[model samples]
Target: MSAATNRGGAAIGRISDLNPVEAGAVLYLRLWSDGAPGRAEMARDFAIALGADGGRSALAILDQIFGLCALHGRRPLIRHGSGCVCLGADENCFAQMIAAAAEGEHDDALMMALLIVRPDLAPALVALSEQFGLMLRRMAGRCAAPAVVH
Candidate 1:
C-alpha cells in the first residue's frame, strides 16, 4: 500500500498518514483557511513542495485539495489585523488554477495565490523556489554545485 494509493480511512480524516505531497496539501489548506500570521509562508512552502515533487499522484492530490475546497464552498483567506480578507476568487477558479498548474508541473497557482495573499511575500516565495530546486536536484542525484575537476 503506497502512500498514493492509500486513500482510505485515515486520509479522509487527517493528513498524518498522507505522502509528503498530500500532507503538504493538507498544510496548505489548513493555513489558507486559518488565516494565521504565517499562513502565507507555510502555504507557499507546500506549493513548492507539490511542484518540486511532481507526479500523477502528487498532482492529483493538489487538484483534489482545490476541488474539495470548491465543493465545500471554502475560500482562500488572509488575515488583515483583526479582520479577514477574502482572496476574492470563486471556488471553481481555485480548482481550475490548481488543475492548470499541476498539468504543467509548475507552481503558477501558488505563485498567484501568494501574491494575492500578500505582495510582501514575493521574496520569500522566490527563495523557497531556489531552495526547493536545489533540494530536488540533490534528490535526483545531481550536484547543485559546479562539477569538480579530476
Candidate 2:
C-alpha cells in the first residue's frame, strides 16, 4: 500500500491503505464476526504470532473491548461484509481511530471514547487498543516472514 509521509517521514495512511497490521486486524475481525472459513487457520496464525501468554492476553483484551461495546449499546462500525475485499470508509475511520489511540494520541482516544459514549472508559479502551494493535503488528510480522526450510 502506498502511504503518505509525515513531516518526520513516518508513513501514515488510512485503513483503506491496508498496512499489514490494519489488514490483519480487519481480517481477524471479519473472520471473528463471520465465523466462516479460514477462521481456524487465522486463529492459529495469531496464536503462533503472539505465543501462549500473549495470545491469552490479546483474547482477553478483545473480549473486554467487545464487552464494553455491548454494555454501551454501541456496535463497532464494520462496513465490509465477510466476502468483500474492499474496505469501506467507516471501517477506515474505525481502524484509524484505534491506531491513533494506540499510539497515545489523546484527542483520538477521547474521540473514540466519545464515539462509544464512554468517556469514562477512555483510558481502559486506549490501553486495550494499544495491546491489541501491538499483537496485530506482531502477527503481521510473522505473516510477512519468508519460510526457511532446512
Candidate 3:
C-alpha cells in the first residue's frame, strides 16, 4: 500500500476539513510527533541547513517547509500585518514569522505562532495560538500511532 493508503488515505478531505491550525496539528502529529522534532527544533535545524547551503534565506526554507506540510494535508495560517511589519507577502512569509517567533520564549513563541493565522492584536494572539496548538497537538496525538501490521 502507498503511504497515504497505509495511513489515512484521504488527503484532500483532510486538508479541506481543517483550518490552518488544525491541519498543522495533524501534520505535526504525523511527522514530528514520532521524533521528527518540535517546532523550535525544526526551525533551528532548518536555519542551520539553509545557512550551510549559502545565500538561502530563512524565509525560503520556511516556504518550502510549510509547502511540504500542506502537501501532506496541512493548511497554512493566513496573516496580515500593520505598517512595515506587514510585508504583504505570501503564506510562506507569515509561516517564517511564526517559525521565528517559535524560537523565542514559550509564551512569546505561542503568540508568534498564532500571528501566522491571526495577525491582529498581540495580547490575544499569543494566548489564542497557544490554545489552538495545544488542542491540535492533543487531537493529532490521538491519531499518531500506526495500525498493527499483522
- The prediction achieving the highest lDDT against the true structure is 2
What lDDT score belongs to each candidate, Candidate 1 first?
0.37, 0.62, 0.38
Residues 93-149, candidate 2: write the lDDT tens digits.
546556666566758756755665466876676777777777777777677869899
For candidate 1, list the clashing residue pairs, or say none.
none
Supply the TM-score for candidate 2. Answer: 0.70
**After best superposition, candidate 3 residue 1: deviation in angstroms?**
43
RMSD per model, one decimal: 14.7, 8.4, 18.7
Clashes of each: 0, 0, 1
Better model by lDDT: candidate 2 vs candidate 3: 2
For TM-score, the strongest prediction is 2
User: Rank order by lDDT, top first?
Assistant: 2, 3, 1
Off by over 4 Å in 3: 1-104, 107-120, 146-150
Better of 1 and 3 by TM-score: 3
lDDT of 3 by residue, 1-150 (tens): 564332322222323344444444334333333343444454554344334332134334334435433443223432222112222223333333333333334555544444333333443444433443443344344546777997
Higher lDDT: candidate 1 or 3? Answer: 3
User: Which parts of model 2 have CA positions greater than 4 angstroms off?
Assistant: 1-16, 36-42, 145-150
Q: Ten consecutive residues with minimal summed lDDT in candidate 3?
A: 80-89
